[model samples]
Target chain A: MRLKHLLASVAMSATVLAATGAKAVEIEYWQYVFETRVKAMDQLIQKFQAANPDIKVKQTTFPYADYQTKVAASIMAGQGPDVVQLFYGWTDNFISGKMIQPLRASAFPAADIERDFFPIVSAMKRGNDYYGLPTAVRSLALFYNKKIFKDAGLDPANPPKTLDEFVAAAEKTAKRDGGGNLTQAGVTMDMTGQDHQWWREVLIRQNGGQPYTDNDSKVAYNDEAGLKALTFYIDLQKTKKVGQVGFMDEGQAAFRGGLAAMTIDGTFRLGSFNTIKAFEWGVTELPANAKGERSNYASYFANAITTKAQGEKLAAAEKFLAYISSPEAMKVWLEVVGELPARRAAALTPENLANPIYGPFLKGLEYAHTTEFKDEMAQRQVAIDMVNRVLIGGETPKDSLAKAATAEQAILDRAAKR
Target chain B: MSATGTEAAAGGLWSRLSLSQKQVLWAWAFLAVPVLFYTVIRFWPTVQAFYLSATDWNVMRPASYVGFENYRRLWSDPLFWQVFRNTFAYLLLGTPISLLLSFVVAYYLDRVRFMHSFIRALYFLPFLTTAAAMAWVWRWFYQPVPIGVINDILATFGLPQQPFLRSTTQALPAVLAPAIWAGLGFQIIIFLAGLRAIPSTYYEAARIDGLSEGAILRKITIPLLKPTLVFLVVFSSIGFLRIFDQVYNINSNDPGGPLNSTKPLVLMIYQTAFSSYEMGYAAAQTVVLFLILLVISLVQLRIMRDR
Candidate 1:
């Protein structure tokens, strides 16, 4: 009787062990903390888990300032996210550093990706294999305060369409105190922000200067067109006296606070701007050059499978990536995060194209150039310093432009060598 | 039986040692944990850093030997030289100015009996506040016309508004102001303690000698406060040399910006390591910083001690 009882108990324990063995595969996901992005990702994770009950995903976040450092350190220590979110510009660094692995062709086919996603999404493609995929993309546009335009005696419905019109409107809208101090900025001028992108890809190209040449391996913005582009930017503050660099400390702050008349910003700013109840704003395409040529800068953050993902974890990560990159997921992301969807079908719908707020940004995508940055921050800093030298140091635009081109070329050369 | 036998054997060994020898053993046994900890935690990493400084490591790939290429590159890098100058400026300007201001405050506060601790606490309040928070507050204070307090005051007085953090020339000093202020409390407290330690008799003797207040301060009080002065100069010098948080938080949009005007050695090291992910180059920078700190501290000690 005792032997029989023991045998039954042993069988019960084996069944319990087997049950535990077949439990869900848990994988970790990491992203820099942006409120709407985090919320959208959380909602998607739930939807993904409900559909694929055999997999569980744990999401983690760090502040944007420390995100790169945290990822580099944690992944190097052999413990970190199975799947990670990285800026599209950092794809090369991530690929070369072995922080992320290429997607399996069977899981994510290059042909399918090329067909469905925006052509700019090709930035993530390294040779034949794709390193990652973006759920959304961003493009720059002119965000103007309708009330400010009316206050300055300009038509609210008619924002600037050309570079000359932009300057004229800015000069009219600009207000100054009795002592010559600027009371109201005609437009925001912050080089450390999106202005760097505006100057490099938009203004330079509009003026017939290619920011980079030879497949983005060399700087090519040191010519007369580049000088003209830079001079025009500096003249807004120096000759025109329509704006100041450090008026309200930041361009976005000044715009949101209603201290500035206009700002050039990206699509990612839409959600935050929508929350401001103080003013009614309008979005317009970036001002074109004399020949009616227009340009813009497009950028995005993409989700990638980290090198840490292997075997079961790798399968789980790929599934999560696929789910996040789906059309349905793009819809949810657009509703939550206010960034344009990466897939052409998801982004270019009738309702979306008709949206005045998102329409300008989408229109910008048609002529946008995605700069293949080897080091985004360093290159951005060079542009910032170039403008500051002209603005603060009283250096001529010609000298500053040459200096910037040299500095950026050195950065690219260093990265290439590495 | 074996356990008891082992215990008995250990006891026999312990009993055979002299009293001093037993005490020495006990002391070593007590020190064993910390020494082991330091070896693994501190010394090992420092030694590893030296090794890494000689190699090309970007954290992801396996490190390969690169001789002194990183060091050679750093030597030629103009940013390195500018950063070096900025660091020394922080040390020279920040150390002396803060020490003087703190000394004056502490010297006067020592004689005031009413609300003394409260006044000291008011000064100490800033020290307790986080560097990031203080930097943000100061940043707001330095803003233009309608937003910034300083500029607001200037506008009211009809004085031209100064661009504090924006101008490359003014930015370093603007960043330094809050750093000096934050450290004032601790330095004041130390000075006060040092002043008190000089004893009431010294002041009384100076008074009896018919020395003026200034004379008393110059001849007696300062001389007696020499040791305290030495400690503070060294302490604050090190503090200024390693300054990072103030400069970083002040102009966060461009942390050593407006043309890298206020970038310090530590900030440069952090950027090289984290932003650029050039571990080997960062390690070389780190070694340079370590040597600078070591040499400065040694020179200060030697000068202060000899005098």
Candidate 2:
């Protein structure tokens, strides 16, 4: 009788395990570990699981610095996330590496994506197949400390709108000690940071120069306009003396510490900046050229389904990707992460456009250019070296610009060959 | 019943074997684990690297034989040469300076009795700390004017502020300083152990002979510490040659940046492999580094072993 009882129980437990194994499809989602982004993803996951009871999503995060390396190593080993978050700049690399698969047109139609989302989202497109979708987008704007402006005797409400006015305000607000070292800077200059983007996308465009041509595959920034743009950037330190490089080591740090009056940063900084209660800050559109033409650089982190997902897991991943890229998820991402929604309908609402802190950045999206980078890190390093040559190496701007163009052209050529 | 049958069969075979053969079997059993481990873990990957070095394996596409192309590219690459110089700079300067500093501290600290362990712990604290954390602290120290401790001290002394990490000329040394400091603790401990192993009677005999302190250090302590010195020289030379962590972390905004002034060979290999995903090219660089390390170590051993 006891043997019969054990047999019955064992059969019952097997049935229960089989039932669960059939009912649920589990997929892993991965992203870099930014506090707000992780929190937002968790909330999204909770909502997703509740609505789709048959699917379970597991979330994994790695530090931003190590995220790419971790993703590559794990995927190469054939065990990693089904859905992974990647920088839009890395979409090409991912496609070439076979790390991710293109989204099915039935699930994500190319025409619908182009009509609904901002035009910049097309950076993820290659031959009518989209590899990824972004929940939010980021663009550059000038962040100014209102308290510093007031102390410097400039109207806090009247921020600079033109390049000449911007430089004038910077010079007026800058404070220097007896040693001629700036005690407080008018602006922060860090080539290693977003300054490279500001110079390449905004300054060069405003100066009537195209940074790249030939389908964004060739260097065209070696012209006269490029020389002018580079010179303007260098003179901010050498001639204007309004700010110094390496003054607090980082540009954002100087602005955060209230030592700099103005800094050009991206919309992603909004979440962190909102946390600081020491002083109030305001965002404004980047200063325009003499002709009132403005430019900005836009970028985003996108989510894609990796090649590892198949059959049931692939179906679940498709559902998860669609849900996250929906208007509702974009709204949640905007509220929590301070990045703009990718879709025009979701981002261009009346209330969102009128928001004082977000208005300037939202306006910047209309004219922003998304650089189609072959290798974003390598390209950024080229821009950095270009600036350093003029600033530290004491080279001429014309020479530096020519050298940079040649170097960047070589990188692009090499990438094209691959 | 089956176990007894098998045991009886094994015993019949074992009884026929000679004593030396039995001992040889035991030794083979003992050697198998480590041999298997090294084959799988160390030597296999090394051999694969040599093979992969001649192929164009970008991790995404299937590998194709590119023989000598990667080596030829590395030969003409200016950045590789710069990194080569930076790596040698770390070895030539870092090894000697770190050795001297650790020896000095260990030599003096050996005689101290008051709060000795506490002081020794303080010196060793940096070694135990993570390189990432220690590098960040040093980065902060190199910041300018109102933020940096070093610059603040410079201001007090009426000296001009130095652009330590920002300047290409100074960034290498600035990075090397913390690396040398971090290794000092371990080197000092080794030196202390070596110093303690020396007989106290030799020192007493030296005192009786009226040898000066300088003479005692030069003749007695120096000669007795030869083994320790040789080991440390080779060990630290290897350490300095492959220096990555401190340089990578300090000024992380641009690791080996400001025009690649502080970039070392290891960092270049890392970028080429991971960032650019040029696995074959990275493998070629790795083979070069392996040869360099092998040659340096062998040379060091040969020179030191003779003297």
Candidate 3:
């Protein structure tokens, strides 16, 4: 009699909940698979579910290589995830393709976003509407091995503050054998990875030049500033002989193996650096140009709602996004995933601003900007071609940059028409 | 009664048909499933790809007809020409090298009676392994000194470390080495089966006639293995022509790295379609690849066929 009464009460409550328009709704969220990121997302989902009793969040992750393709294909098939996390680099395609819907004004106001998030959020906005909000924003900083500095008779506490000093320090720390093969690289200057970031953001900007124009619909990096930047990077390999581009990971593997002294990489690398026990390393602001002006590149991945979502599903997705972007969730991401928060109230706190490992990256947020382009992959190919022409093809920087500019301009023109 | 009588007369005439006609009808019925399947799945997409080649489709908008514009772009693009050379290089170098190495291994191992099955299984092991896994292991072997096993061996011999996958001139061969190694196992297995199928009487007869071992191999063994040889050559040629996974995996950091010295045609198609979302352009490139593969295979078959 007691068991029968208990079953009857549970069934009655379920029926009443359904009748009152409180039926359970499930929303799927997708992201790229990363160790720390997966754990952090799981924690955030648990917190979100606790707040919304009638909503369920199903999280899926794809490998980094296949994430974009999977999302685009799924959307084309009309079965995409309700909410998806996309890199800011991919924002243009998703928006123009009409794969994602913009946030409703009443739910997420433009003023609130501008005041809360970093300035780089402007890249995610079109006209008067914003597309997405990041939980964390990343910036590049100088990661130097402390022991390499000490061995080279340089001060361990004080890293290079200017490009000239940085080169001098690299010369002292770089080690080559009798035959001049690079056994230990000083810094990674390969265009294969960080060299492009260092050139465009730090060198070009510090040289007092803009990297693009016309709402990022034009390629304007073929001027004097670009020439100087390319010359500076090429000198590291050809003239200064501090590094070469033929290594496994563009000297990243060498740096991690204690064979390289320094590399300019994003804060996402801090998690990987923490696992290294062979060397003592520290992070500092990227070295400035001769004028003492500094700049950095900022990138982020943000949650976006898909066009397939509607009505109840859209409401659930919006609520989930709001919870994930909250200060509480940002703090959890920072603590668990080591990605610095994008929210001003969370990131600008005294405790966060004082941390030695993360402080330099946070400082970079003041002057950093996202590199916007119409077709990022095509432009990246152009950069690679430009650098390879100078480094391996033995072509002059003047000639290569001119040709690359023409090619990039053609792509931009085509993109504009499309 | 009149309709029933007419149907019975037609049924009686059908039952009186010849045995060969019944067999032909039965064969057609059996083949219908696969024919319909291929028309729907394979042939339809191939026809679509040809039509899409002339249009401009980015998977976002409705495909618009653009005439021969995509083909014109492909003709003018320098990367397409370079990739064309790289693709042919793989087919020309990879097929013969893999075939020769497998033939040598199978020839020698056939005569060995000591743990023959075990040796054969060892030779066939790599065939069962995944291409991606094999490529990664080979990538580790091609790394710099103190990490790469090959460079480590060179160091032990007091020789200088050589950059394998990093150098442009050496990268294609370095990538090809693993591809050839992976396919060798399957080819060797097929060769062994072919060798086993040959009766020993021919060899014994050649020996009794006082012919040398070399003469017997050239005169009898080679002639008997022509069919297997032709099959393997064609199969291996197609595999080499479509080489993508090995290059893509070994050079995952940059899909076609060191200035794309090792990029095959398929990898370029993938990048053009997926990375840049130029579906029509990629389709044009795909049609070109199809033509090349078809021509190469037909030419090889014509040359290596019965004559």
Candidate 4:
């Protein structure tokens, strides 16, 4: 009876909040999502509307292919959303110590938020003035076929541990059909802005070297470490006969049709592979470097209040952020969006940490590395193009990277002026 | 009564608008919506692009006035020059080939009056499809592997499998094949229309004068189709200079990859602007590209008018 009385009082307050008015203060947020995740976002937004009766959120979404440019253009036009989503590294450009307010010190504990977020791990400059807030994080991983491993007489439970082991394993699994042409490929190392493998970047760092050194301003990875790493990648096809020449990702529909026994991709693709009913599959760590370290590449999805969003709109934006970045909102983000949670508290919950399907992701995050380029958008294009040049241009890796650095520096200098 | 009639007569100009004039006004009234729609959707963006190109902007931060510095920088960019060279190379090779192929098809189609309409529509089908969809269908077709269909058929006859798009030597030609495929049909249709409009008297006169089949074509048809040929060449040049969607989709790995073999000037500008987020540099590229395109278009127009 006493519990019923307390529930009744709470319900009355909720009702009073609801009766405040129609046309509540509406805020817009732009994010990137697709497929089942988009549906999950719709449901999550609906729930938020119900919880906060006086605040409404109008959501806009675009595919990852065009979201960055779209957001950048919108912000410049002075008509961007009240709250916007970005990649982790993009915050530096907008923050510049002006524009975008810090996380509300009164509404949320800044110390706790910083200590609990994975993005803070890689942040260089700590400050009382924060411009970026992240909601979820993830890293790339290698996927292999259990049936193929058992057929090769290797332990299905233990995949390749080192880069050499991976090469040997791949060579063993690859096969050509009756005609003297490739029918099954062991791996694909194609790099582009789209569906490009981040494994290559991480492997260089793990192979007793780093992709970026000197606070990420130098192209340190393009030297001996880069040559060793790339030679290993190229020789997989050119000499080792493990990877097929010109066998890009688009040609891998056959792989999903159960042609190859292994593939490397991001955690986001696990849901898609779940639909491949033909083959029994399992997840594992990416192959380790010669130094016996297995590291993968990671990037984050962050939200920053735009320069256009200030005053009451900025205050409202912070309140919405406080709600969205709370442990509760992040849970909805991870479970519903298929993203690994960014907050430590949200991630520590046993349901996320112990879920056998995603436990590898939690473990993989510990060894993840970021790319060496500071200006994320610039190097992302020029650097990837340099890799393609090395692969197809037949230019030595060192020359290609030096050329890319020239182009990347030009882009960085241009971006810095604004 | 006299004063009242005079007052009514004095207001005559208001009612003097005739039915024909009113009907024309009503037609313009109906067109106002479409005109407004086109102005806002098309012309507004062009104006906006021009204004935005004058600023040092990343499309993220506050835009600042940068005068003509963007244009100054583009003048010195070597990569921009390379892209321009690629675009011109594609145009020089791709345009004449389009004209000759369409002329041959148009002449043959015109010979068979019974099947002319049916064959024309049949060949025109590819032009109606979107470039993106066509590019993918062709990307697989251009695969260098012997397993690819084109190579498979070639291999069956003991011919070597050509690297249709994967090779630095072959990538540009491979990309141009689809443009030729998509473009030939339109030129063929236009040439066919021009052929139909040509009077048959000239062909009959050549035959009476003892001209051979080849002679009649050389003397009568070539002279008559000269105008259409020039127009087709100039129009196709403008279209090919802006080559992007086909090159972009043909090989997403690198449009100008295999050592910058296929990058068109316009596509590079697009990459610099949206893909790289260097709006100032992209604008400089645009202004320079605009001048090149403008010069080509003006020269073509001047020659066409003189002809």
Scored by TM-score, the top model is: 1
* TM-score, chain B, each candidate: 0.95, 0.94, 0.91, 0.85
Better of 1 and 4 by DockQ: 1
Cα RMSD of all models vs. native, in order, equals 4.2, 3.8, 6.0, 7.6
Give a tens-digit lDDT track for model 2, residues A111-207.
9999998888888988889999999999999999999999989999999999999999899889886777677889999887799899888999999
Better of 1 and 2 by DockQ: 1
- TM-score for all models, in order of appearance: 0.93, 0.92, 0.88, 0.86
User: Model 4: per-residue lDDT, tens digit, A346-400?
Assistant: 7766776677557667667766765534466446667556766666678877787
In model 2, what is the error at residue B178, expressed in angstroms?
A: 1.6
**DockQ: which candidate is best?**
1
**2 against 4, candidate with superior TM-score:** 2
Say which docking band candidate 3 falls in. Answer: acceptable
How well is each residue in A83-113 modelled by candidate 1, as lDDT tens digits?
A: 9999988887777778999999999999999
- Reference-based lDDT, residue B108, model 2: 93
Clashes of 1: 0
Task: Tell me the tens digit of each residue's lDDT in model 3 across A1-418.
Answer: 6678889999999998677655678889999999889999999999888989889899999999788878888888899799999998777778777889999988899999999988988888988988888999899999999999999999989999999999998999988765566677788765656667778767877777777787777777889998988888888989999977655444567778888899888888887789889989988999987888999999899988989889999999999988888899899999998998998888988887888888899989878978876677777778877887777677999999899889888888877666
Compose the digit string of candidate 3's lDDT tens values, residues B1-307. Answer: 3567666878887698799998987799799999999999999999999999998887655589999999999999888998998888898899999999999999999999999999988888988899999998998898765467897687767678777776678889999998898899899999998988899998988899999989988998788898899999999999988999999999776677667888889999999888788899999999999999899889989999998
What candidate 2 gets wrong by more than 4 Å, as runs, is A1-18, A21-28, A45-66, A69-82, A307-320, B1-32, B113-115
TM-score of 3: 0.88
